[model samples]
Target: MQGLQQFFTNISQFFEFLVVYYSIILGFCALISVLVLGIIMFLRKTVLADRVFAKAASWGLLILCLFCGKLKLIFETKAGWYTLGRWDLLCAHRIVSIIYIVGIFIFAAYFIYRRRRLHKFVKGLDKATTCSFDNEIRKYPGTISPFCIGCIHPIIVIPEKLDVQNALIVIKHEETHIKLGHLWIIAGYDMVRCLLWPNVFLHIAAKYIKRDLEDVCDAVTMQMNGIDPFDYGESLLANAKEIMLSRKNMKCEEGFLFAWDDNYKVLNKRIHRILERNGYDRKVVLAGGILFIMALIASIFGIKCFSYKRNNPLDISGIYSMTKMDTVVQDTEEKIVTGYDGDYIYIDGAALKEAYPDAEIEEQPLFVFVGGYYKIPGVGGGGGWGEFSASDVKDGVFRIENHDDIDVWNWMIMWL
Candidate 1:
C-alpha cells in the first residue's frame, strides 16, 4: 500500500505540473467537445438527444465554472492560510463556478442573437428550384453544405423539387444537431479551445470526440430510416453531383463543412459499417464508461491528496515565522566538554561567541574535547528546546542539559 501510494503521489504531482503549464490546452479540448455536440443538436431536431448532450455539457460547464471562480478568488484574496490553504478550497471553487456561469451565459446570449440575425438575413436558400410540393426535388450542394452569405442566419439552399422526397436521411442528420444542441455546445467549446490551441493532444482529442459524436448520430439515423444499404449509398452519390465546387458552398467561408473532410471521412465509414449490418458496439460504450470511471477515481484521489490541509499550530508558527527573519546572528558561545549520557544541548562555542560577544560562559561538567569542539548536551527540567520557563526572557539563561540516565529528558536529548 505504501509503495502504491507513493507511485500515485508521483503521478499526481506530474499531472498537476502539466495542468499548471497546459491549462489553456485542456480548456480547449473541453470547449471543442461542446461546440461539436451543439452543431449536431441544432442540425437535428430531437429533444431526447439534446437532453443527453445537455447533461454532459452541464458537468463540463460546472467544472470549468468552478475552476474560473477559484482563479478569481485566489487573485482577489491575500496569500495565506486563509486564502490558499485547504480551508479556502471551497471558497476558491465557488469563485470559479461563478466565472464559468457568467461566461457561458454571455456566450450563449451572443450566439442566439447572432443566430437570429442570420436567420432573418437568409431564409430562402433551402427552397428547391421549383415551388410545387408534389414534384419538388431538394438538391444538396455539391461536395459542401450551404454557406452563410449574409450577417443574418444564412439559409440552406435546396431545390424545391427535392422536398418531394421525405429526406429522411437529411432530416435525421440535421435533427441530430438540433436534438443534441450541438451548436451552443460547440460555440462554447470553440471559444475555449481557441484559447488553448497549442496542445496537440487536446486538438486531436477534440477532433476525434466530435467525429465520434457524428458517427453515433449516423448510426441512429440508419437505424431509424431502415433504407436499403444500396439506396443510401446511391443517395450520397446523387447528392454529391449537385454540390457546387465554388467557395460559396463551403459551410465556413475559409473551410468546407460537409466536404470530403474529416467529418465526411467518419461519415463514410459509419455509412459503410451500417450497410454491413454492424450494430452499435457495446464494447465501445463499455470502454468509454470505464475510462470515465477511472478519471473520476483519479480525480478524486488527486483532490484528496493535493487539496489544502489545516496546518497544526506548532508547524504553522515555525513555517510562517521563517519568512520574517532576515538573519541568524549568534550572540554567545562556550566551549565545554560533556559526558555523552544522551542529555545535552551542544552549542557551537564559536557560534555562541559570535552571537553574544560580551556574554560570560560558565560551565561545570565532565567535559571532553573532540574534533577541536567541546560537546555539551543539555536537557531542561520539562520544557523543550524552544520552550521557556515562567520567568521573563531576560531572567532565562541558556543552560546545558544535566547528564543523567533513565530520565525522559535524557532520552529526548539522546535522539537529538
Candidate 2:
C-alpha cells in the first residue's frame, strides 16, 4: 500500500513537472511567433499584418509575464518556497501538458530498449578469466565482468576461477544490486534526465539518485557478509587484468561478459567509492527537494498574475459586426458596411440603445484572448453593449468584447 501511494505520488509529481515544462515550451514558441509577426508587420505595412502582430504580441507578452511570475513563486528562497508539501507541479496548462508527458513515456521506452541491447551485447563478451561459471557459461574475449546489464534482470558473469572466499564477497555485492533493484531506479532517473534535457533540477536529481543507489548497495553488501570490504575489493583487482578485444576468442565470446577495451578506470572508481563511503547528508537532500517543488508552484500562480482578464462570454449577446478594410466590407445585416475585409460581428446597437435610453452610443474595438474572453478598449460600464465601428477597431477580427454568449462567439474565420 505504501509502495502504491509512493508510485501515485511520483506520477503526480512527474505530471506537474510536465505541465510546467510544456507551458514554458509553448510560451517560448508564442514569443517567437509574436516577434516574427511584429517584424513582418513592420516590413509589410499592411493593416492585417499589423493587427495579427498586435494580437500575437499581446499573447506572447502575457505568457512571458506569467512565466516570470511563476518563476518567482516557485523559487523564492526568501519565502521558504513551501506550498504545504505539494511537489510544485505546474497546474497551469492542461492539453499541451498531457501531450508533453505522453511524449516522455515514448522517448523513455526507446532509450531503455537501445541501452539494454547495447549492455546485453557488451556483457556477453566480458569474461573476467578463462574459467566459466557453469558448463553453459562460455569463456569470452574480455577481462571485465558484465554485471551492469539490464535494469530488470542484470546478469553479472563472474569468472569461475576465484576462491570461495572471494566468490562469496562478489556474490554478496551483486546480490545487493539485485535485491535493491538499483538498476531499474537508475534507468528511470536517466529517462527523466533525457526528457527534461537541459534542466538543472533533473541533473541534480540524477546525481543524487545515482550516488544513493551505489551507497545503499555498498552498505547492503557489507551487512550480508563477514569478509572485510577492502579485501573483497582487492580480490576484484588482483584476478582482473585489463584486456581489450581478445582476437583468439572473439567469435565465441560474442554474447559474453567482457571488457570492450583495456580501460580499468571504471572498476578503479567503483573500488574507491566503496572505500570512501563516509558521508551522505540528509539535510542537503531535503533542502534540494523542497526547492525543486517550490519553483514549480511559483510558476503557476505567476502565469495567472500576468494574464490579462477579459469579459466572460456570458455578458454580451447581440449581432456583432467585423470588417477588414474599406475595400472589403460586410456587416451582420447582410449589412455590408462597405470596404472592410476579414471578419466582423454586428451587434444590435439600436436595441442596446433602446434598453438603456440614456446610455451613450459609443464605438469600441474588441480583442479576444485564448480562454474565451473578449476585451473592449475604452469601455467603462457594467452592462452596456455600445455601437462599435469597423474604423474604431484596431484589429481585423472584431468580437463583441463584452459577452458570455457561446453561440455568438462560435463563428471563426480567416480575414484573408
Candidate 3:
C-alpha cells in the first residue's frame, strides 16, 4: 500500500509539472498551427493544389504541436514581436493538476471500457461459417449503418436492413478504409482528440483531418477498384441520408481509425470532392508542400517578445544583470543548494560566490528571485511555464516576458 501510494505521489507531482508545461507550450504551438493551416488553405485554393497537401500539412502540424515541448532546447533567446500574458492563477493549484490528470484517465478508461464492450459484442457475434472475405463479416440488426471494428482479427459489421447491392458498396468502402490504413490514422487522431479535447484549435484541426481522411479513402478506393466516381458519390450520398445512422455508433467508440458516422456535412463535402477529383501530379504537390511547410514553420513560430520586470531576490545590494538563461535548477544538471519553496527562486550563497568571486557571500541580501512558481519545499524552486531562471549573478536577467510563452526568448539589455 505504501509503495502504491508513493508511486501515485510521484505521478501526481510529475503531472503538476506537466499541467503547466504542456498547457503553456501547447497553447503557443496550437496558435502557430492554426495560423499555418489558414495560410496553407489559402494557398491551396490560389495554386489549385490538391486537398492532400493541406491534409498532410494538418497532420504535420498536429504531430509537431504535440511534440514541440522539447523544441525549446534547440531555440536560442531571440526576441520576437508579441508577448504572451499569464494566467498562472489557472495553473495555480494542485487541484487543477488533479483535474487535468483525471480528465485524461477518464477518457482512457472510457475508451478501454468502450473497446471491451465492443470487442465483447463482436465476439458474441455469430462467426461467419462461409464468408467471401478473409475478415469476419457479420450482419448486425440495428439502425447503426455498416462499420468496421477491431485491430488484430478485424470485423466488418453491416446493418441487416441494407439490400444486397448497397451492402456490397458499403462493405467495399469499409474495406478500402482498412486496406489503405485509414484506421491507423484514425486511431492516432482519436488519441490526440482524447488528449487535447480542451484545445479548441485541435478540434478545428480534427474536423479537417476527419474530412481529409474520408477524402483520401474515397479517392483511393475509386482508383484501386476502378469504380465510377459518379456512382461512388451517389452511393455515399445515400449512406449519408440513411436514417439508420444513430448515436449507438458513437458509443461503439469507432475504435481504431473511424466508423461510419452520421456527419452530414462531412458526407456532403466528401461527395463534392469525390465527383470533382482533380488529378493533380502528386510529386509536384508534395515538393511544393515541403517548401511551404518549412516557410510556414519559420514564419508562424515568430512569437513576439515583450519587456517584463519582476522583483529579483538574487540582486543583493550591487549591480546585477546578465543572468545566464540556461542555469535553471530543474532544467540543468548542476545544483548547488537552497532553492525556492513557493513562487520565487532563492539564490544559494555558495553558488553566488562561485559566480561573483569578489562579492561577500554573507553580506549579500537574501537572494530571492520572484518571477515564476516553483514549489520545492526546502530547496529554492522557480520558473514560470517558461521559467525565468535568473543568474543576475552575472548580467541582466534574460526574461521570456510572460510565463505562458514557454518558448519565447528573452535577454535583459540593462540592469536596475
TM-score of each: 0.40, 0.40, 0.56
Q: Highest lDDT: which candidate?
A: 3
**Lowest summed lDDT window (length 10), candidate 1:** 312-321
For residues 1-416, write the lDDT of model 3, one tens digit per residue: 99899778866654455565445444444444555557645664555356554554456555555544223322223322132222223445556545655666776787778778887876766543334475778866544556677666678877566776667667777787788666677677667656655555655655556566666677766766677888888776665545334434445433233345436665666677888876556577558777877865764354211212221222111223234322223212223223333333434445545654543432332222233322211111233322222333433222222222122121111121
Q: Per-residue lDDT of 267-375 in model 2, one digit per residue for the tens?
A: 6765775566443344664485466456556755666554323332223233232332121221333222211213333433344344333223324333221122322
lDDT of 3 at 254: 32
Query: Per-residue lDDT of 56-96 in model 1, one digit per residue for the tens?
Result: 43234223322221232332346523533332243235444
Query: Best to worst by TM-score, what's the order?
Result: 3, 2, 1
Predicted structure 3: clash tally: 15
Clashes of each: 82, 50, 15
Where does candidate 1 stray beyond 4 Å?
Answer: 1-163, 181-188, 191-195, 204-206, 244-268, 281-315, 318-416
lDDT of 2 at 199: 38
Between candidates 1 and 2, the one scoring higher on TM-score is 2
Cα RMSD for candidates in order? 18.3, 18.1, 11.6
